[model samples]
Target: MADENAVIVNVLDLPIEWRHNITPYHEVRDPDLVQQLRASMEAHGWQGPPLVCDRDLYEVNQDQAYTGSHRIVAWALAQDDPSADMPCVFIQDIGEHYSIDLGELVEENFGNTYAAVEQFVALLPSDVAEAYGLDNG
Candidate 1:
């Protein structure tokens, strides 16, 4: 059960304070990211909670927000009777609040996959090395 005090608002009613921070991550590869998500949502409904963190806890000067926030807001915007409200979870207290470094999270998520590629290359048989311009010697 969720706490009665835990704030849950419609996707439309979300104020600037709650949403001004969230950042959306989109890729050119995701051609229908905006369309598909909204379409599926119309048929069904939102299955996930907004990724929120305490505002008063950490003071990040140059910070970015959690990924996919725009989509959540967009989904709200497309509704016929859109309220644009969404849940905003906050840490209870200044001392007890927990949040992660957004920069680190982004770096981790978007880190280069060179290591994986190297591993795949290492697995290739030496017999094919000459064919692929490799000299295992």
Candidate 2:
């Protein structure tokens, strides 16, 4: 389970190896989407903090992202210094039994939105959905 508490951490403080897509095969390469995200971050700043799981809890060497790959990417792209630390929320108390069905959770939380649905449909295949028990059919 993830700890309800969140904390501020620097983007650069995050381990490079752990910066991975939360949803498998959901790498967003769309320049337009990236641009839009960058613009949003530039204008309003990071509204939602990225969710990170503690690697030590999972016996891993580095912390991993549970969500917010796009935001991290946008922060990297929008900043004058990519390594500069920006305020972010890090999820604490993630244990070894923590579920990897993050994609489904994100979709379930935001699936009604067009962008969320588009991204979910674009990246998540039926097989993966089934594996995560997120398949509608």
Candidate 3:
């Protein structure tokens, strides 16, 4: 579970143009892992949303993948749909060394994290949503 201050949002929550604006934090070095991820997603849909950093906090700029960059790439390759409704859990603070409050931004743009997640989940494809047990949300 995330800390109390963080919000779990998704790509669908962002404006249409921003949905595909996210980028990997670094170059993917393991092609084999990406292939595996692609296979898994093709068979099972998304296991879970990727964790992302809300870069620039106050603006709808490019977010960076904190985890699951490989999965993001795999999804893109597998689906050929960069604009697909991909889920993401946004972190406010990485650790004591870094503290950026993205939750406030989420609240400013989309009420609150919980509401945003509910709204996004409802937009997911039934099969995909059901696989994550988020179909009822």
Candidate 4:
């Protein structure tokens, strides 16, 4: 659980260096979606803070995001001000009892929803697929 007293920080101040790859595979970027998000943010502003976890228990003093990566990216791409501040909810002092394994967490969070798999497969070269043994047909 996060501390009830979490403070808002500048988006540039976010500890992105400590970020973990919480997704099982790369997600294809959608320019249209990015544009939509940008327009939304420009018109309505930020809806909420991104959820950030304290990595101090994992021997790192930085915070990592277990969620809201896309929102963060959208903010970066959309915001005109480089030093723009955004609200962030920080999970304070999480220890082993509250720890989640990365792989399991990714699986639980994303659930293998490869909605763009066909699009991805279409872009792969045949020799590349065969090299990776992914040439099913």
Candidate 5:
């Protein structure tokens, strides 16, 4: 579950100099997947927010993306309209949270990364989910 205490912030409202500090554990985003995400945003707009760490955690003023770098990029590319806000969950103390080990949960639930992706993709809109070859069922 998403943290109830998360501070919602518009992605574009973040400091211009603040970089997206992606963790080493995160997979390198596939270009094809990014394109699909861009297309999805263009067609139906962003569905959910990404998890980002507070800027105070970094000495260089970087915002750590706990998840959703692709979505952020796709949002910016699909629409640069200032009024289009991408409300992201900005967590202040992610280290203190118990929900960080997604790998363990994913392995327990689906037994593999590919299955986990499909399962999550199914949560999106019907058409978007179908594009990824997964049904809501």
Candidate 6:
């Protein structure tokens, strides 16, 4: 909903003041995804930390609580696994200002059958939606 797309800033770029752990959003991964990611990691090693943020991660927008949490939890769980310790980069203080385009968000969630962009967008502030030219209603 934020006008500007979620800027993929370097993990190192975030402010020190923003660091905080609200805990990862837990989910029982589908066996297939776990297997697939496991295989990918075996061959490539942990690519990088999953994009994440602290409790106050949202800026112009809100609701990473629902959409962005899983991405972090999956990476954390993977890292904990004895087999594949994928080192994940946990982000802090991100939100509408950090959000990428709706299409980009959808693409990031590619494997999922349903579109969460609309749902996330719905949770964004009115100003955020308007910024993205999405709050037509």
Pick by TM-score: 3 or 5, better one: 3
Quality of model 1 by C-alpha lDDT: 0.37
- Cα TM-score of candidate 5: 0.42
Candidate 2, poorest ten consecutive residues by summed lDDT: 88-97
User: Over the stretch 16-127, how does candidate 4's per-residue lDDT look in tens digits?
Assistant: 2223322212242566766776677776665544434334434554344433545545555556643334444333211121342333433554643232222333344555
lDDT of 2 at 12: 26
On residues 1-137, what C-alpha lDDT tens digit does candidate 6 reach at each position? 11121233333444322222434344545556666654554455434333342233335332233322333344335445422222223222324355634444556678341354455546667664453333432
What are the candidates' C-alpha RMSDs?
Answer: 15.1, 12.1, 13.2, 14.2, 10.9, 12.4
- Top TM-score: which candidate number? 3
**TM-score order of candidates, top first:** 3, 5, 2, 4, 1, 6
Between the candidate structures 1 and 3, which one is better when assessed by lDDT?
3
Better of 2 and 5 by TM-score: 5
- On lDDT, the stronger of 2 and 4 is 2
TM-scores, one per candidate: 0.35, 0.40, 0.49, 0.38, 0.42, 0.34
lDDT of each residue in 12-118, candidate 1, tens digit only:
22332333343332233454666776776566554444433335323653222223444455556445434443344331211122222333433554753233223
Residues 1-137, candidate 3: write the lDDT tens digits.
Answer: 12222233343342211245566655677999999978877777666544444454436666655456676688777677774545554443321113324454457557564454445444446554453334432
Candidate 4 — which residues are off by over 4 angstroms? 1-29, 55-62, 81-83, 93-137
RMSD of 6: 12.4
Instruction: Pick the winner on TM-score between candidates 3 and 4.
Output: 3
Spell out the clash pairs found in candidate 1.
10-85, 10-86, 11-84, 11-85, 12-83, 12-84, 12-85, 13-84, 13-85
Instruction: Give the clashing residue pairs of candidate 3, or none.
Output: none
**Shift of residue 129 alpha carbon in model 4, Å:** 37
- The model with the greater TM-score, 1 or 4, is 4
The candidates, ranked best first by lDDT, are 3, 5, 2, 4, 6, 1
Report the lDDT of model 1 for residue 86. Answer: 39
lDDT of 2 by residue, 33-126 (tens): 7788788767766554444432333445344443455555666676654543333223322211233343454577774433443344345545
Cα deviation at 78, candidate 1, in Å, is 3.2
